[model samples]
Each structure stands twice: as C-alpha cells, then as structure tokens.
Target: MSQDLFKEINHAVLDLQGAQLQTYERPLKRLVSLLQHPDLETYNAELTEGLDLETFLEESARTGGSMVGSQRLLWPDSAEECLGLTFLLLQKMGEDPAYAATFAHDFYYSGSKIIAGIHSLTGQLIIPFIRDYKSYTQSKGSALVALQDVRSRKVFIVHGHDEGAREMVARFLEKIDFEPVILHEQANQGRTVIEKVEKHGDVGFAVVLLTPDDEGSVKGGNLQTRPRQNVLLELGYFIGRLSRDRVCTLKRGELEIPSDFAGVVWEDMDAAGGWKQSLARELNAAGYSIDWNVVMR
Candidate 1:
C-alpha cells in the first residue's frame, strides 16, 4: 500500500475530538468497515489489544512532547505532523488485525491514557494513510480534464542566453493568454519545488536559448550547452511519456539543432526585436491562440 495514503488518514484521525469527531464519524465508520472486512486480511494488525489513548492525548498537547500539539494544527506545517500521526495509525492496524474491527467504533471514545499508550507503542507516527483522490480531482476542475482528453497541447521553446528570449516568452505567453510555468521560476527550493512538481512536471514544451558559435571550446562560443543538455533531458522524458510532436524547438542564430532534436520543427527568432513576433506566429500556427499585438506591446 502507499505509505503516504496511510499517513494522511492517520493524521486526520488523530485530530478527532468534539465537533471534529462528530464530523468524521461517517468516514471513520466507512474506513473501519473497509479495514475490518474479513476477506481483505492483509491489513489486519494491532499493536495493542486496547490502545493507550491517555498518553497519546497528553503527548499531543499543545505545549510539550516531540510533536507538540501537531495533532490539533491545520494546513502548511500541520501537513508534516499529520504525516507522523498517519504513520502510527497504520502501525497499529498492522500489529494485529483480529481486534481491529471490534474497536473500530469504540476507538473514538477511548480516553486519553489508552490513546497515549497506543501512540507510544506504535512510535507515535504510524498510520494507515489513505489518500483522498477526490480532493485532487476537484481542484483541477473538469475543463483541464477535457483538455487532457483532447489533442494533448504542449509547449516547447529553445532557450537562448539573450535575456530577451525569457522576456519574449513571457510576453508572448501573456498575449496568448497561456500561463506557461517557466523552469527558471519553478526551480526554487522548499514548498515551491513540491508545488511545481505537482503542477507542471508534465508541461509540453520548453524555451531554450541558442548562442552564437565559438571554435575555442567544446561548447563553442555562444552555445549555452549546459542549459540545452538539461532541456534535452527534460524533452526526452516528455517525449518518452508523451509524443515527439509535443516539443516545439526554437532557435536564435545559425546554430545546428542538436542531432536528437534535428527532426523537430524549428523557427528563427529576430535578433533585432528578439523572438517576440516570430514566436507568436509559430505558436499561433500550432493552434495556441496568441495575440501578436499584445505580445509586442
């Protein structure tokens, strides 16, 4: 089973109390029923015959203990503690499955002492984490789903060192009303990374920079080889998963397209005004609605 799903369900359950308990009753019962079904015997396990709830409630207090009131928090930072709680819950269910069904409905009523012992014995982190699939489905909306079903629209750009290329891409995107998540902007650390991975890992195209040639080095003079290498790897991943046509390769000067991408359609960008007009025209032809005037503006 997915460990993450176990953690999520566990953390949510540990927060049960008063109104929270009341709110989760139906779901809890359903979960209990799923876990207790005799035929689905793989998940059967129990760390303790009766959970030590008191110590768990005490450790979960707002002021002390390793987790320190994580059970009661919500969102952002709460997501981690929620993971910990889920971890413990799964552990308990795995210790012994026989008693699982009998305690399903009664787990909520178990006092703090019983909860604490269970938490302690089960490492205070194990959980039968189950993911809520509907949450992700609803957030993206049906339009995205429809778009995914139709002709798969993807974006690919040849990255150039000319700072104008970045600005040009941004401007053209605005004109087309297309919000392309640029790699430079999304490569940051922390929560930003996670969000980017979740949202744009499947982007259809890339904006690559083309540099003027130089004979002195392996990369030549203007060839920004490193960035292209990274983009190529990304393209390969996309092409392997999606299709070759999804990647739109563009360039600035007389640089030869990489042997791997030689067959991809290439467009020339104006050195004087950057690639604004040329890119807009090409993207528009590809069925992406792009406003040349707005991009120029």
Candidate 2:
C-alpha cells in the first residue's frame, strides 16, 4: 500500500466509535501488521518524520531524552485517535529486536505526559506530547519550558454568555477557596476580547462555555459566525504553556459537540441546570482555583 493509503487507514482507525468496534478491529490489526513489514519500514516516521522508531527510541534510551512536544489538532478529528494509535505503535516497535531494548530503556528513563484540549462547543481537540528524562534533571528548549509551567493553581471560571453558568462557577470558586470572575457578566459592560484575555490570563482555571453564540461568523446567518472566536483564539495562544487538562469545556442547550473535540471528555449542561453543580464538583476535585501569588511563587 502507498504511504498515503497507510495514513488514510490510520486516520480511519482513529475515528472508530464504540458502535463500530467490531467493524474496525480487523482493519486496524491488518494496518498494524503492514506497518512493521521490512519493505515498508523505510517510510519516515509519521509523528517524528525522518527518524525511525529504532533510532529515536535508542536515542531516548541512551541520552535519557525525548522528542515529544505540544501539538494542536481538531478534536473528534483524527488527532484524538492518533494519540491512541501512538501507544499501539510504541508497543509494536518494542517487539522488534532493534527497538525493543531502547523502548525498555526509554520507558524506564523518560516519563510521558500526554496533554490534549477539547473544545466543548466546537469539539476541536489539540494534543501535545511531553517527556522527562530521569538522567537529565534540567530541561532545555521548548519542551523544558512546557514542563516548568506545569504548576498547581487555584480555581478559574471562564464564561461566554451563560449567566447561570457564571453564577454556578462563582459558587464553585467559593467552595474551592478562590474567587471566580465572570467574563460574560463583566464583558456585558463593554470589554473587548483582548481585554478579557488580558485580565483572565493569569487566573487559575478557565472554563469556557461552548455555546453556539460563542462562535464568530464571517457573514450573517451562518452557524459558524461570531461567537467563541475571540475566546478560542486566546485559548489557542496559551496552548504552548498549558496542558489540555487545565481547560474544561461545558456545552449548553441544543448545541452538539463539534467534530474537532469529539475525542475530549465533555459534559452536557442542557437540562435542569445540572451543569453548574456538576462542573463545580469536577473543578474542585481537579484542584482548580486562583492563586494571587502563582506568578510570584
């Protein structure tokens, strides 16, 4: 099969749903077998191009270093599936004599942190890779910066236009020993998107309401027009520093999860104000809250 054919098959496997499990098992298994063929091993690595698994894994083992970093993608899209596929590939690579020893070595020396973002409204998912080498205690480069930024924070609440959700987040904040700032409520007084991001950027937690109204439109009457564009764009800006788990998405009303974020863990707040209480519970458990001294500390 052509490289493109392999990619297409891999992409399809990533999108498999529970309902399609029976149908997907066979094809995915075959694809896995094809990837390991000696003749086909020449294709550059998909995620880390130009580096074969044996070489990368060996370097990771010998140097106690890794190459995984932050990556963004459309959720429910192929990225989420890719995350799972990678693990499978790792295991397959380990079976090969050339890669097995290094795989074992790297597994012992390097810790993996997989971060992914799920947009509740649009369902766009971004996936990033991270690693820590046990031998090299100091971090160097963008990967090191990403690791350093992983600090604990207080609770934060990001609101789009849902007043009730805002109130719920506020109450949740109080429970978590932090104050919640409602952007929608404050923005109603006339603040631009930039101003909102500037003020809330430092907050401990950011909960964006992914309702239809949050998306921006290029023209009037189109479903994709003017709503969460500013908020999402701002969120995208911080992708380099924060892991996906730091962000949570809540959808309200008849809105459905966007194709991109389909792979993320999302909650439905469509009925009976259940979302407010549930979200508060989850955030508290996640230790999300604001700390005035976060930056100072």
- Number of the top TM-score candidate: 2
Candidate 2 to truth, TM:
0.37
Runs of candidate 2 with Cα error greater than 4 angstroms are: 1-154, 184-192, 214-227, 237-241, 256-260, 270-273, 276-281, 284-297
Q: On a 0 to 1 TM-score scale, where does candidate 1 land against the true structure?
A: 0.37
TM-score of each: 0.37, 0.37
- How would you encode candidate 1's per-residue C-alpha lDDT over 1-297 as one tens digit per residue? 444443444444432211122243433443444444443242232212234443554454433335322233121243323433443454445454333322331332122333322322222112212332222223332212211211223453434355667676666665566656565655555556335444565553444445443222244455332334444565555555434323444565665445776656655666565556656554433234445667777
With candidate 1 superimposed using the best TM-score fit, by how many Å does residue 49's alpha carbon deviate from the native?
Answer: 67
lDDT tens per residue, model 2, 1-297: 345643543343332211121343343344445445554343323323432434433443454334432112212244323433443444364354234223323332112311111111001111122112100112211222222222224444555566666676566556545566655545434667666656566654556665555443346755643335554564444332333444566766555344555555556765665665555544432333324343122
Q: Pick the candidate with the highest lDDT.
A: 1
| Count of backbone collisions in candidate 2 | 28
